[model samples]
Target: MLMLPAMARSSCERVIVSADPAYPPLHWYDGKQLRGASIVIITRILTDLGLPYELRYLGPWKRVLYAAKNGNIDVITTLKITPERRSFLIFSELVLNNPVAAFVKKDRPPPFSKWDDLIGLRGGIARGNRFGSVFDEFMDERLNVREADNLETAFNMLLANRFEYVITGYHVGQAYIASANIDDKLIALQPFLIDSQNLFGFAAQSPCIAYLPAINKQLEKLHKEGFIERALAQARADWRKTPIIGKN
Candidate 1:
């Protein structure tokens, strides 16, 4: 079993959680409120613990990270655990594996079967999305990738040939394609970039860090009972039912 550090003794009045507004089936803003598996799981954990909490939609993914880093947000419901993020956030145990994929236009798939195949080709990713440390480093050193403000823009850009591909979370990418009715234009390349783990991150300076131990324990219980998988499926179905929130 993975052991978390000793629990903090500070008093936490409330836990404010947020996530990338574009990452559906994990977390996203559905026109008005945040919805998806990550939000469902985290909120359930907090409720069971009897913790007072508020789920905020702070806007873009970049601003959400900024708020968490500065302790303006108490928790990021789901995100890749990155070394840079460790500076100000204490992460919970690995919640689940999330695959990162390269989305290319169907009629113009790039020469991509390996990581090196992507070098020298132009790609785009939503701002604030990271695959894993190794892939991120490789992308920075050799890839010509643009960071769009959101996934919708990245996919539209891919369609417009602004770039050859859009690298993003596989499920969320699928959600966007489906919601926008653009599945005919784009498809994810085989063999994902990386299978990254999704985790809950608490602002290191926030009193909410005190609940890390309980959160991890509840997460373990949920995982063991298969609640996480069920939640993910339900979220995907729910997303399909909700009206598409923004322009395609």
Candidate 2:
């Protein structure tokens, strides 16, 4: 039902946007189509810009990153900046604030008050996903981090006592817990490890890389109009309707 603006129509050039189909509330593949807060926001921005684009649900997080790095994809709906990623991507202004937290089983919560407390404990993270520069550095040097294919897999491993905790976005963790009917069994550790600002990014070599400034400008306008907040709320409500649990 959503149509591109007449004034914003484009030629044959199309921007290929890649996103992790398993990351919900933010975005996820609903059997046949991609839908979520970021999807809606990006859709509006692209439509307003009159840009031809295709939204692809290539996932497992790692594959999405690989595609973006190789310029096989033009844009990623959301990602946090990392030094390695910076080599191949140019990021837009902040798109959303995602609070990173550690989730643990309720019966055996770890005593973690500071970053150093995480050392020695087995923790799970999505393969090829970075929490932040500092956390990633600490993880590399001190923590015993186990990699999973996706957040759900990591959470499952945590529940099976394969790991002491699983690190992921707070909202995402909570959504999965609820969806899996394990809310009473799992709890997100307080205070958060990091508050990451999610951003739109373009492959450095993509022809659409030139559109960064325009995208940022539109993102700023969307923020000012409270469009982002409204879209997020709608996304949360919609996600709750299905409450999908598993790979995505």
Write down the TM-score of every candidate.
0.91, 0.89
lDDT tens digits, residue span 42-132, model 1: 9989999999898888887788888887667789989997789988889999777789999999998977789898888889998878887
Off by over 4 Å in 2: 1-12, 245-248
Best by TM-score: 1
Shift of residue 117 alpha carbon in model 1, Å: 0.6
Where's the lowest-lDDT run of ten residues in candidate 2? 3-12
After superposing candidate 1 on the true structure, give the runs of residues whose Cα lies further than 4 Å from its correct spot. Answer: 1-10, 246-248
Q: What are the lDDT figures for the candidates, one per model?
A: 0.85, 0.82
Q: Which residue window of length 10 is worst by lDDT in model 1?
A: 2-11
> Could you say which candidate leads in lDDT?
1
Whole-model lDDT, model 1 = 0.85
